[model samples]
Target: MAGDEAIRLVSYDPSWPERFEEERVALEGAIGEWVVGGIHHVGSTAVPGMEAKPIIDILVGVRDLDEARACFDPLAELDYLYAPYLPEQMRWFCKPDPAHRTHHLHLVPVNSQRYRDELAFRDKLRSDPGLAQRYVALKRELAAGHPSDREAYTDGKSTFISRCL
Candidate 1:
């Protein structure tokens, strides 16, 4: 919860996948049936051996936004705070607390471009160490330059991510 907007990147931890699994089970119990596709671990943390921020990024593929919207209450009951941060394409939710988020849930349509792109990017990074390393380097540079600007830090990586996709 401390330094919520501050950018902090750390070396990869083998525990990230396990943490994702734990969250996945909890999430499945909460709203798994409502989802069209299964949940996925995306982002830098999903890439093994890649340095990243210590937050787990989860992609929940739902049939549509309506189904995703319906998950707000159930997810909240499980400590996932719902936010209409990206209503156009996805429903955003953060776990534990927004101020010190441990997980981020992005609910998008299973067949949407965003969904495919995210998975593709993650898969590419997982398969290619050089690509993953470059991404890690970019993240580190962005974190150092915009330590207090979360939006800028994310925006800075958009280009690289798009290319990777």
Candidate 2:
């Protein structure tokens, strides 16, 4: 699906915290120690008072993508589908087989644009409650449609997200 329909927002669920911990343990064991610089649970789900997509987004930083590449075997063995957003651009991995895999692992090279952008966007949302509320409102509106229509939803929010970025 080229990741277009992956953004499905869900009402804030208290269970998300437990889900994150469960995921962190599984990922740390499956992907090995050094493959991740620091595995962070970012996105709205990570924050305490924000609505978010049901999916748990995990940010895995590495010395380089090569270090992350080594985890492909272990990760896939655990049912994660590895796909790069853009091979020439950067390397990251996720469970295309979402149910089978537990988390969205973005293995970004330290200090890269993509990494910075992810952090910036997430931090902006965290620090500014007004923007977070706006995001929540937009997501609620978007959620009325097909939750799986990732592309349509992302396209719709591009402007709002860009401003936050």
Candidate 3:
């Protein structure tokens, strides 16, 4: 776990998509052929009008984990620190500058279930405003109860996410 910060959900920022696009272009330039499918903006921040933790979650579909790993140096050059937080599932990278952490890159195989689930969840949230609102409420409640516990905050929403999926 990186240094724990209180979970703070803020109203959706209109600039989130632009931020994702900037990162996406940089990532595609850095990793070219390794990226089998296109990059996607997943997670709460991707949904318009959804209150979220202010972190942009990017999903990059690669040919395989090995190919993804090979791009570590390139990604690092872009200031993305490879954090094997979930090594078994995917390649995770986080920006070291916590104060300006505008992105998280999750690298998974193009056809992997994790990749599909994430895209589906994000799409569902975007298409269904009521569902998005319900998710926001759950996040707010969870954040209130587990302000300093990142694990708890994340776990609290598993059920809701599962249901959504």
Candidate 4:
């Protein structure tokens, strides 16, 4: 419900990984049984020295979309709000609110293309500082252009992300 938040980029925080780990542990405890692949920290925050939106991006692999639907209630209990974004591909969630999120969760099928690509993109950026810097530049430009339009800001980065993938 809070999807209309402004876009703001922050300097890379050394503690992002730890923040992610903390959230990962919480997610595992709340929905471990439904996780088929693994819980991962992905997105810009996962890379060192990359400017990001200060939200920890988490990826949780489940058996399939149908099975994943069961997680809505549990995730809600954990204060994750479910968003019907790309329901055909995966289940998306944010906490504590979408407008001002501290974390983003993507529930995808184990071993799916999206699951693999997400990890691949993160790994690629982690290995290449130049690439990461380029991404950061793009992100800053996008954020400025779409300061209050999260969807447009994200859409603007698709081409760059696809090329990286």
lDDT of 2: 0.72
TM-score comparison, 1 vs 2, better candidate: 1
lDDT of candidate 3 over 1-165, digit per residue (tens): 657556788988999999989888888899977888789999999998888988999999988887788989998899988877778779998875544566788999888888899999999999998999898889999999988787899899999999988
Which residue pairs in candidate 3 have backbone atoms (N, alpha carbon, C) closer than 3 angstroms, thus clashing?
A: none
- Lowest-scoring 10 consecutive residues by lDDT in candidate 4? 1-10
Task: Mark the regions of model 1 whose C-alpha exceeds 4 Å error after superposition.
Answer: 1-3
TM-score of each: 0.95, 0.79, 0.94, 0.96
What digit string (tens of lDDT, one per residue) describes model 2 on residues 1-165? Answer: 543444556677888788878877887887657554567777778776888777778877777776667878887776677775666545656666643334677777766777777778888887888989998898878776746665577677778888777
- lDDT of each residue in 1-165, candidate 1, tens digit only: 334656788888999999999989998999988887889999989988888889999999999997677888899898888777768899988877767878999999988999999999999998998998888888889988989888888899999988776
Candidate 2 at residue 149, lDDT? Answer: 69
Query: Against the unseen true structure, what C-alpha lDDT does each candidate score?
Result: 0.88, 0.72, 0.87, 0.91
- 1 or 4: which has the higher lDDT? 4
| Per-residue C-alpha lDDT of model 4 across residues 16-110, encoded as one tens digit per residue | 99999999998999899999899999999999988999999999999999999889998999999998998888999989987678999999998
Clashes per model (N, Cα, C within 3 A): 0, 3, 0, 1
- Residue 84's lDDT in candidate 1: 74
Q: Which ten residues in a row have the lowest lDDT in candidate 3?
A: 94-103
